[model samples]
Target: MSWQYVLELIQNILISQTGIPHMTWGHGIMLLIALFFLYLAVAKGFEPLLLLPIGFGIFLVNFPIVPLMGLNAEGHMNLIEYFYQYGVASEIIPCVIFLGLGAMTDFGPLIANPKMLIIGAGAQLGVFVTYVGVLFFGFTLKEAASVGIIGGADGPTTIYLTAKLAPHLLGANALAAYSYMAMVPLIQPPIMRLMTTPEQRRIKMRQLRPVSAREKLLFPLIGCALIVLLIPMVAPLMGMFMFGNFMRESMMVKRLSDTAQNSLMNIVTIFLGLSVGATMQAEVFLNWKPLLIFGFGLLDFVVCTFGGILTVHIMNLFLKEKINPLIGSAGVSAVPMSARVSHVEGLKADPNNWLMMHAMAPNLAGVIGSAAAAGMMIAMFQ
Candidate 1:
């Protein structure tokens, strides 16, 4: 009860809590950055589903080394690190997301116009371009491959490929991919406008033929066979994606398809986000490499968007029918988001313009294209 006792107790507590003393100004900076992302996810509604968990993970992992991300003094992986290992490092979470995506997607649009496949492949120019560009920055081929995938704008593919080729850079690549995806509406529009005139944006094509259920069911089988045969490395993600689509098209496993689309997808997304965020410790994330990755990511997106539009122009030169160039911008794998951006831009050019279904073709194809790109990256390292 004496003053001496109180002072001694306070000294003991401060000495025991290592995190309190070991914390540096860098920790504060990272924490603030995490808070800003939280604001974007919560208040600004920027990819809230992933950003919210990712922001919290960043906050938790940077708190002066409290056994969150890596091996402890006992030489065992910590809790969050386990999630990163089993869920992402093992490539389970990304494949699960693809399964959900396949269940939700309708291949009708891409099926009706098989040419959209080429546009999706064209958009991958950003991936290859950035891959070669990052090598000039002294990155290893594997590291550059991981970084280049940010151009694809497919977070799962980015995570999957980075985990295989450059696990260390997974945090930056995932963040860049998701950030650009969330900003698709903003990053794509100016590029779309600059690449194509108002007349090109307003161009309309004839209505697409309605695809039959039999065709939908057959498409997944054929797609799976061809894609897997070409890129055996893509079997995990692509196989799951095709299986999910088959489930939806089959109409026989409605309950399983529902679970894949809704319940399982929701669960994996939370774990995936947190694991990704946990990788962003101050020591690892606050570096020149991450900064460079961000720069390249922006360039990748701009170039990819440009490539898609350019492909459309080239195709129009040879075809009897002209398609709206805006749909080409959907070739980045942001799913309906990139597609929706193209649709909104089309509407702005001409209110009567409806490009949603048309844009879905390239949007859907981008998913496959990105997966194939990821497989190629994995093959390079293997």
Candidate 2:
């Protein structure tokens, strides 16, 4: 090797030679996205439990060539592949999270007032509507289904379906769904306020008929079996969800149930959030599709809210009971938040209207209704 030849070889290796591959500028842009997500998760208080970890994961993956998430000799990412193999692929995380949800949830409100179940079901119209909308926008049938369910604003179902139908969109879709859920307060009230009159909001209903403990214990299992028989694909989500509730109400496996309700479930959520977040990197993430999907997600949430209120008015034509329309808003199953929003709105309408307990029926029904809707999507798409 002559000195001149050696110098030329070193220069060729150090700099980009003609037609050789090099890192693109996409990565730099992705880093900025990571920071933005982090800011939203932290200072903005946007689904912080899920988003904070996800933002950290995005930052970690884009830091050049760490391969913290990359494949093994078998050609799969250590974290993603492992979870898919054991976490998502096994269909464990969704079920595990359901256990936590079931343990934490109360069914008295829902069972006491069954008609609110209709509101929850009505809210789910957005899920299917968005599915059709996404397809019109050029996403494939499966991709559209995955994107549309983000509107349902149910985190586990979002993850469950995306993992089965649109794995590539998993990170973006999960992030969008949870983020939109956190934004419910900001996104909902204006639309809800406009849709109803102050007088309509002031309409109060009778107190809920109290539900028995036995009815509470029976509802989950019976609902699970009936729903699963109707749509088997959602079994992973619905079955485990009901099973968890059954476990909690059964009062038999205190240790096992407690583990599922608390420690085991919490640990899995942290892993699921981080692992999902890690999948986002600039090289793979910079595009118009995710932004469009996110916009559609917002539209879906708004439509679902409207659907609930509209249903109440339509039903009012037939039913004599003067149910507060605010309770209908809680039918989206945002759990405590959506329920609380109904309470707040009712208080604003009239200081005497204590719609929280009454709203609880619709709020709890929203959980089952959302799960059933999620199950339907899974069956249709899967």
Candidate 3:
């Protein structure tokens, strides 16, 4: 081959074999977005466990021709696609995550104060409201349902519902849910303060009654039966959750509970984050729908927080004793984080006032309520 022929051959190889020549503005924008998420995960410590892997997955799939997210020439799924198919698309990973969550959860506070269940239901106001609001914005019933659950602040439920109803919107919905969950400390306090008075914040709740071991063990069985009988569509998620909790409460299955809470949970979370992030490839994710989903997600969360506090005010009007309205914000179910925010805000209002245990009642109730809401929507659509 002559010099010109050799050079032409080299150029052809470079163009065909490498991703650089095919990179587009969309890929660059996705890369920047991925890096921003990485910064939030690493430097800012926002949901780092999920965000780190998710950010990295975004970085990996945005390259022009990475063999990571789609199918290969033989038609088998690529690496992340396997995770997505079996784990997310099959709706297994989210339910597994719920099992882990249940294993780690304590229902004592909710059991001691069953009235807190109403706060959990009340917190769902935003879910239904957003569902209606998004319809006017052109989201279909299924898509709106998937988007609205972000208010619940339950990442797995968001993923589960989105995967079931609107798999196309999974990346946007999951990121929105987890992003808000990580920012619960930032988002909830202002709403809490704005909705409650100084006296309301200072309202001290009596300590919860100590629940018996039998009661704790029986709760999961009874709760699971009631929820499943009422909303069988949620059986996979709720059943696993209650089963995990049952194992924990049994005290006879320490090994199984520990594995579910720690090892099993961690393993699935990695797959879940990566699978979700990979779905955000430039061609798929850089769109108007995702932006709308993000906006609606924030509104939903705020309204849910507002609804929770309002529920408390309504309850206090009827109760002889008062509830600290700060705990109402914890009804969004960001777990101990939202509950802790309530506790901290309570301390700011009254140094001696402790609302952690009280806040936990609605916090845990929000978990169940969110799931029930998801079940309701699934039933309606299916």
Candidate 4:
């Protein structure tokens, strides 16, 4: 071959071998964002289970000319695409995660105080509010519903609903849901403080009644039947959630419960985090919709936090033995995190005040409430 032709071939191979020639500013920006997420997950230990894998997924998919997602030339999907399709799009992974959550969760507090269910339902105000708000932004009903669940602060429900309703926005919605969830400690306290007075925070709650094993076992069965009957669309998520809880409470299936809580949960979490992160490909994520989703997500969390506290205030006006409004803030479904925040704030006001069990009631309720909201939204699409 001629030297000139050989040099041209060498240049072409060099260009083809590396992503640098094809990388754009969007890719650069997204890579930096992924790195930041990694820093948060690794350095700051912020939601490391989800964030670390998600950050790495973003890093992988953003590389130019890659086929980390989508179909290849032969029309078959790559590895991550398969993971996304079956794990998320098929809606199996989220349900599995719920099973794990149920296995790990202690629903005794919620069983002891059924009234907390109202606070959970009340926190869903942000879901509907954001649903209406996103309509003005030109998102269709399904898309709006998917985006609004970010307010409920339940990441799996958000993903499951988004996958069913608006798969196109899955990457953005999942990222937004999880990112906001990680920041619950920061996002909730301000609104919680602003809405409640010193007296409300200092209000000492009565000790939660010790729940019987029978009540614990019956809760998932009755709760599942009631919720599913009311909102069947949530059957998969709720059914799995209750089943896991049942396994834990049943006392006959200790081995299964342990596997669900530890081994199975850990496996699904890794898949979920990686697939979710892979969705943040630069072209799909670096758009106005993601920004809008992020903005709406923040608003949803704020409004939900407000709604929970407001529900508490409204309830206190009527109840003889009042609840501390701070516990209501835990109704946003960030699970133990939001509940812990409420407990910390309560301690700040009164060192003797212990609201963990009380806050747990609403926190557990928030899980059901978010799943119900998801069901309602999914019904709209159906």
C-alpha lDDT score of every prediction, in listed order: 0.92, 0.79, 0.94, 0.93
Candidate 3: tens digits of C-alpha lDDT, residues 1-382 = 7999999999998998899899999999999999999999999999998988889889999999889987999998999999999999999999999999999988999999999999999999999999998999999999999999999999999999999999999999988998989999999999999998898899989989999999999999999999999999999999999999999999999999999999999999999999999999999999899999999999999999999999999999999988889999988989989999999999999999999999999999999999999999999998
* Total clashing pairs in model 3: 0
How much does candidate 3 score in TM-score?
Answer: 0.98
Q: How accurate is candidate 2 locally (lDDT)?
A: 0.79
Clashing pairs in 4: none
Over the stretch 53-143, how does candidate 2's per-residue lDDT look in tens digits? 7788777777665556768667866765575557765667877898788877778877787778888887777787888998888999888
TM-score of each: 0.97, 0.91, 0.98, 0.97
Better of 3 and 4 by lDDT: 3
In lDDT terms, which candidate is top?
A: 3
In candidate 1, what are the lDDT values of residues 1-382, reduced to their tens digit?
A: 9999999999887867667887888899889989988999999999999989999999898888588788988999999989999999999999999999889889999999999998999899999999999999999999999998899999989999998888889888888888888999999999999999989999987789999999999999999999999999999999999999999999999999999999999999999999999998888788899989999999999999988889999999999899899999999989999999999999999999999999999998899998999999898788
Query: Model 1: how far is 296 from its true place, Å?
Result: 1.0
The TM-score of predicted model 4 comes to 0.97
- Which stretches in model 1 have alpha-carbon errors above 4 Å? 1-10
Ranking by TM-score: 3, 4, 1, 2
